[model samples]
Target: MLGKAWQFARRHKTKIAAVSAITGGLVLAGKLAESKFKQWQEEETRKMLEQIKKQHHYENTEKTSNETLKSLFPALIKTIEKSLDSEPILERIKNQTGNKIELWNELKVLSFARALAMIITGTQLVLLLKLQLNILSGILYIKQPSQVLSSRLQERFMALSQNFISFSVPKICEQIREKMIQLLALSLKEKFTITQLEAFFQTTLLQLDLPGFQKLIIAPDGDHISQPLNPDEHLLLDDLINNIVELLEHEDYAKIFRIGLQTSLSNVFDYLAESYLSHESYKENGLRSEVRLPVAKLIPILNQSITVYQSVLHALIKHYTIREYSANIYESFCQAPPDAIAKPSLSTLWPF
Candidate 1:
């Protein structure tokens, strides 16, 4: 059967070749046509995209110019009003200069002058808007100039507010401290002797159990100086009490008290100075300098406040420690000493 089929195929070989050639040609033509259609579609899409981009650019330019005109309109109106009023000044000048210019002639001249000024002002506004629009669209890809301008204005306003706050907080803190000192003095009827106050502060610091109280210097990172006391540590409590008592015994205790407090106050003053000076310099020079205005003003104030807050907490702890230690010592010492008593129990011997 295979031999007979091969013989029949060979007998119609010419006809088979004709059909195969026609089918292959049709397939090749179809592929070429499809390729051309695809290229045409891509070219059409590109043209459409270019057209859309051009239209968008035109609209942006138009919108930018319109906004510029709107912003300038009020100022332009005011200028015109001022120029019209200046007719009197111009006439007075003419009279004073002995130019023999009539008031009515001057009025007509001022009217023409005001109109010309308005036209010139309008043209200038349009030109400025055009330039800004071109710059934003070409360089910055900003579709709306007004939005960009508004954002810039808002940022400047915020910076100004931050600068004000940074400078004012230190003065405010100083005033509060003064008031507190006065109140403390008033509450204590008896004059606080330097020695007695020193004792009081020493006792307080001992009771607070705060770390880094004896260290006069603060670290730049602030974290090392501001850590809180460990409540579970009995040794910390004893050291805190001992230091407070020692401090109280010092003759110049008032001057040297609250080491952390002094560090904090110094930090605050330094910060305020840095912030104010930077703000002033920024106004004088500009923001284009090596020292960024925000950095110069913001960093100092933030770091100062953080250190100050830590110092304040440490000072409070010291105050409480002193008071508690004083109370305990007074209670224990109210009676005879353990050695003086005939037979003291272990509990009575260590009145901790």
Candidate 2:
């Protein structure tokens, strides 16, 4: 429906453009008028508020003595023992502010915010919670310190940790990918338009063994791929595999893979967590000690990595003559211009 309307407007672009301009002008005028009206209303409201203040003789009330407040408010103040029947003198308060509604609105908002904060923080229940914690600690291990968590709790703890890590993998992967993309943006040109991708895809298609594949699709009775695709009566079938590949390439694979990873991990998370709990190491004694041995485990891995790296360096030096290359580089650097040194290399065309 919208497409047809757009087509119609496109056909009568001049008329449509004029209409749009007029409509936009009317909207702008309406907005300006509304703004002016709002200003006028605010001015009228201010004037009305002033008129109300004047009519109520609030200026006279402002001259009330401190002695009068001490006498009147003190009398009005209610004791806890005495059945309270004291109310604020609304007129006196209203006279002082000359804005009853505004004062009440401010008070209501402030009270609500204070109450919300109190509830959120559990300020009133802190003492109760402290007592509960003390009792639980006593019950759990008043004598034993290290046995604060039981075997059951250890299981729960492991399970909780496994679940947390397993579930968090998607988010972790997402952040890693995001950071990778940020780094990639520095080097990789973000030019992934469909036209460019399709051209690339077609070029890749030309390189494939499509003719060999087409031979298999031929009818067994008599037909062999003479034109590679021109079948009986020249009823040439379009290359289905190429069509499929084209269709696949045209899809948002990045989006598809991201969604698939998230969905796949959602199911995998539970399986991974279950497997972690069932692992023999976790079932054995001293779960806490094992969990704490990350640094010990990491040290060996680090040492292995260092050894591998050192060995790789040795191999590269032996095989690639990297040291010789470095010496050649140093000599070239020493001979070249100090500020703008040129790199010297063996010219492949004239190495001798």
Candidate 3:
């Protein structure tokens, strides 16, 4: 049997070898195909996960940016709220200048320019506050009266709005004036010598253009045309300054200013409240339930006020010191400047 099988195997050896080789090749091909398929699947999965991760990161970054922009205005309001209180300003002045007597001496002459600034600031603040209150009341009563906020809630909000306004108006005015002074100082091309500064002050003091100033403050488009003061208005301005200087000499000048500021603030608030908050619906008799105001709602109103006030303040400052008018002063400051050898002391930009 072995001999017969051997002889058969030898006779068909080539065919048998061919069949064995074909089977081995098929198994190897199958294994290679499986390995390639696994590699392809892994690559596809990695790409998909990476794509998703990138999308998520982009979305998060965009959301963060939007949130930051949204918060900026409110943050400004909060900063003003925290920093510009009457108490803080008074304390700061006291700490800087010590006694009222010291303050009086330091401020005696310096207060003239500052007095002009204060007068303008006080007037503008009152107008801005009224405008802000009106807009806020409009939003509460007209725009979002029903949706998100109920009418009853609107009335409650109005009632509480005064406290916010009363607290904020004075502080905001101070903050703005502080910014105005800083900006004015920074915008100058160079430091002024005492002689040049005094000359500049004398030249420009009475020449402040009221019509031009008012135009800049109220105009939507910022027009900073350098305007000169007329003879009559110059006299009036002089008188005003004189009156302020006389008032400053009084021992209770600070107290008087505070009282006047508070009075003006109250009057503006009262006028606006009468106009906006006197809703016919609020007069109707009903069970008076208290409405709680969300801080979120108040922010938008405050932000609007801040925006308007800031813009106006900037406009006024630029108008007050437009390069066209200021060039004369600048030229004087620059031409044939004092020798460094003779005057060893540094020339101060601010006179006071």
Q: Give the number of the best model, judged by lDDT.
A: 1
Off by over 4 Å in 1: 1-8, 11-15, 80-101, 139-352
State the C-alpha lDDT per candidate. Answer: 0.37, 0.30, 0.36
Q: For model 1, what is the C-alpha lDDT against the true structure?
A: 0.37
lDDT of 3 by residue, 10-45 (tens): 999999999999999999999999999999999999
Q: Give the TM-score of candidate 3.
A: 0.24
Q: Considering TM-score, which of the candidate structures 1 and 2 is the better prediction for this target?
A: 1
Candidate 1 to truth, TM: 0.33
Q: Which clashing pairs does model 2 show?
A: none
- Please give, for residues 4-81, the per-residue lDDT of candidate 2 as tens digits: 998998899998889999999999999999999999999999989865654343223222212222332222111110
lDDT ranking of the models: 1, 3, 2
- Estimate, for each residue in 26-119, the C-alpha lDDT of model 1 and write its tens digit: 9999999999999999999998996677557555644554554455455544544443444464546556754433433343333323332332
lDDT of 2: 0.30
